[model samples]
Target: MVFVTAGALDGPLLTATLRLRADHAPPGTRSRVFAVGAGLEITAATSGTALAGAAAGLPAPVLLLAVAASHAVAGLLHPVLRGTARSPAALSEATSASRRVQ
Candidate 1:
């Protein structure tokens, strides 16, 4: 069903998101970062469920379009947000330095 398909699609995205969070979090704060990320994800899911319930009467096409639009916005934002993060070279150097210290 559609729900199963959606859940399957979400698997890789969730994994990548967690990996990215781990990569970006400060060395001593990875657990806190993951906890915060999970809490936020849960809050967002709850909010989305409430919104969907409230919009239950809306036409299916309209809801679908809204979902598509949100996806498009997220896709566009990804590059812009990524640009603000440390580059891969910097991250590798930091990792190497940390390994040396350990």
Candidate 2:
């Protein structure tokens, strides 16, 4: 339990630090993408270890599977979400629609 707590804390703390670094980085989509990946990796790695430790009562293979799943969800899932938000023109579509309504 204690181990899990200590290790689990790694993700959020690292994420906050990464966010600050990301903010200071060049203002561009590339920076934003990097920041997101850094955060996700930190979270997945931290949480993966924590969860793996807690899996003592479970089967060994199960532990590996869970940790891998967590990593995938963190690293891959977030980039997809961020990717979908990339279309700057989508916002303009809303503005054009509003103009037409007015």
Candidate 2 displacement at residue 96 in angstroms: 16
lDDT (C-alpha, whole model) for all candidates? 0.89, 0.73
The clash count for each model shown is: 0, 0
The alpha-carbon deviation from the true structure for residue 9 of candidate 1, after best TM-score superposition, in angstroms, is 3.8
| TM-score against truth, every candidate | 0.69, 0.35
Best by lDDT: 1
lDDT of candidate 2 vs native? 0.73
Which residue pairs show backbone clashes in model 1? Answer: none
* Total colliding residue pairs, candidate 1: 0
